[model samples]
Target: MSASVGGAVYAALAYLAWGLFPLYFKQIAQVPALEVILHRTLWSMVFVMAVLLVLRRWAWLGEVLRQPRLLARFGLSALLLSCNWLVYVWAVQQGQVLDASLGYFINPLVNVALGYLVLKERPRRLQWLAVGLAAVGVLWLALQTGHIPWVALVLALSFGFYGLMRKMASLGALEGLALETLLLAPLAAVALGLMSWQGRGALAQGEPGTIAWLLFAGPLTAIPLLLFAAGARRIQMTTLGLLQYISPSLQFMLGVWLYHEPMSGSRLAGFAFIWAALAVYSLDGLWQSRLRG
Candidate 1:
């Protein structure tokens, strides 16, 4: 029981850190999103490699490197992850954090659909209902806004596919992320080098504060994920599922209250439908867990 409580706290902290990511990204808003992503990829590789070195976690990495098929799979996952990161940074910089939060809010539903389609896992009736409700909510938002929420959809789909790839990955979270960053670091370093040569790199010409924030990206990208991995290993899946909402909920609040993003009645209504769907999904998950227990 004590371990469970500790796990819950760890998970909460992880989600809270993720929720507050907009603030971090906002600090680097002056930097180009792609450049920021490049720096992130580069620094995160450095930090995670240090972690693996300290822990002597090299055996599994060698095994994975021996398998070309595994390397190719992680390479694709890395691309999807980078795409997700780029979109998220762009969204935050564009003052569309609310839309970004909406993407995460709809992510579980996307996961459900992905499971059904890709993994051939059948969701229960309540899960299907939840997915339908979310779709309707997304549709309503598109109709009311006179356009689709492409930012939200792209973030959702990219991250959803990233998650799918990770689910099939053999490495643990730390190792998987390390390998992904390793795959991406070369291209990222080249991009940064090109930017520097052209006198456009933030690290080369930006303010000291900006350079510090960019450097902080290493731990900023890695710590929460490590915390999440620790928590996930110790907690029940149902608890983890419910806790996942904390990040998006905080992001939504930050968007509306802190950032003062416009929240129209139509937008609120659309969010209301999504919130209702989440309620159904959460309740059903809890109920099913109780039955299984």
Candidate 2:
């Protein structure tokens, strides 16, 4: 197969896996989200370390270790990643998967706004209009729901900042993730130890099957990421931008259909506005890409 086709397949598969993550997390729904996050961090570190070891990618680590500023920056990125994970998992476990999905749906626009505000990359007027529509959608959702959609907002913002940091990162995706997890491992270890000492640990109180699923989280987390990185390397930006909606779209369907989350007309209308914004933003991007070409 051609490179772009292969890349599209890889990217779609990655997004498909990510879209179905609610199923995976639901299997361990009995476990506390924080505990799940801890296990995820520990095992992700383990998994990535093994991958690096196999690839003999230790040189980067030594260079990274010498740079205190890099370490500090990654430390902050690690915090944002963990926060994103915690909020997302918590939302899923709490039956707020729709909110979680909406967060991701909003994430692209978040990236654009962040680019404009933080990176000083000027977005076109259409991009600004897209952001405005999303804001209005969010506001309408708040009015209808009687509260802010904090879960969606937190997930979007945390992940947007994390993506920003990664854009500035010196390492590749696997190595960056490895470093982020390395920074997080100690906290995970300490927290798990405390939980074990308090007799509240998953090993102590959870089922064997549940513990097994937790262990599987490592591969599950890393595989899609690897696929995405591989796909991204071979694909055009416009293709990647358009394909990015797959995960959230799947999540939204699963939320409303499988999980039976309430989808009121007002809620649907808010989502309509968001979708319209994305349509405008994506079409504009496509036009720009064509013009540049």
Candidate 3:
């Protein structure tokens, strides 16, 4: 019980940090989303290296380098993560945090589908119903708005795949993230250097505060993720699922209340359907968990 409580606290903190991510990204919105991703990649590598050094965790690198297959697998996961980051940062910068939030809200359903397809895990009946409802909501949004919610779709799909890849990875959360950032950092460094040399980089054009904020992206990115890893280890999946909503919920509120993104009734209604689907999914998962125990 104590462990569970501790996990809940860690998960809540992680979600709170994630929910507040828009506030951080918006501060650096002056930087192009791609550049933001690059800096994030580079700084994350630096931060994780520092962490590993402090923890005396260098042995894993030697073993990882001996496995070419592992490297290639992580390479794909890195690409997916970078794609997810790019779309999210772009959405936030483009004043579409609500759309980004919607993507995350839809992500669990995507995970359900992926599990059924890739892992042959049979979802409960309510899970299938939840997926159908989410699909209908997505379709309604696309039809009524006369534009598919691509922002949300990309975020959900990319992240769902990223999660799937991570689920198969042999490393722990911190180590997996460390490997990903390490693999991507060289390219990210080259790109940032080229951008700076071309006089278009954040370092070249931004104010002192902006440069600092950009640097802070490393720890900002890593910390909540570490908290999440810690929390997941100690809690029930049901508790973790409930906690995961906090981030997107915060993003949605920030978009609607703080940033004042236009929320038409049509969009609101679409969200309503997705929310209902989530309700059904969550309740079913919780009930199943209790029954199994």
Candidate 4:
């Protein structure tokens, strides 16, 4: 029980940090979202490499790289993660942070669906109901905006699928992330180089504050990842599922309450549907957990 509680604490802290990510990114509004992503990818690579060196994980890294099959899986994960990062940054910058929250709120349901479809896993009836409710929420958002929130959907799908791939790869968090970041670094460098050549690099013309804020991206991206690795091993997936809501919930509050984003009837209905779905999902998780015990 104590371990579980600690896991929850770790998860909560990670999610809270993630929830506040928009405000941090907002500080560098002068930077293009892709440029920000490039910095994140590049610096994350540097940070992870340093950690690996400190721990002397080069043997493990070399072993993993020698296994071309594993490298291929990690490469796919890197691509998907990159897409998720880029989309999220773009959404936050475009004043659609609330919609991004909605995407995450619906993510667990999507994960469940993927489990059934891709992994051939079976979900109980209540779980199916939860997925249906979440579907309704997506529909409501579509009705509200008179267009599908593709940015949100893409973000959710890419990230969710990335998680699935990571699971399949069966790599430890640090080792796996190090490789993923390494794979992405060259692309990020190219992009950053182009931005510099175009005279639009954030570090070039942005304020000292922006430079400092940009540097925070490396630690911000890495800390939660480290926490997630520790917490995931100690907690049940169901518990993790519940905890995943924290980030989006905080994002939603920041959007509606802090940023004063619009809260129209359609969006309200969408959020309502999502909450209902989560409640059902939570109940089902508890029931299943009890049954397993």
Pitting candidate 2 against candidate 3, the one with the higher TM-score is 3
Give the local distance difference test score of model 3: 0.84
* Candidate number with the higher lDDT (1 or 2): 1
Off by over 4 Å in 2: 1-14, 226-243, 289-293
- Clash count for each candidate, listed in order shown: 0, 0, 0, 0
Q: Write the per-residue lDDT of candidate 2 for residues 128-243, one digit (tens) a residue.
A: 78778877888899899999889998988887677677666777778888888899999998999899889997977888898899999898987886676667566644355456
lDDT of 3 by residue, 62-181 (tens): 999899999999999899989999999999999999989988887766777777788677777887888788788888888987988899899888877776776667888789889999
lDDT of 2: 0.84
Residue 3 CA displacement from its true place in model 1, Å:
11
Where model 1 places Cα greater than 4 Å from the true spot, the runs are 1-13, 227-242
Model 4 residue 273 CA deviation in Å = 0.8
Off by over 4 Å in 4: 1-12, 229-240, 289-293
- The local distance difference test score of each candidate is 0.84, 0.84, 0.84, 0.81
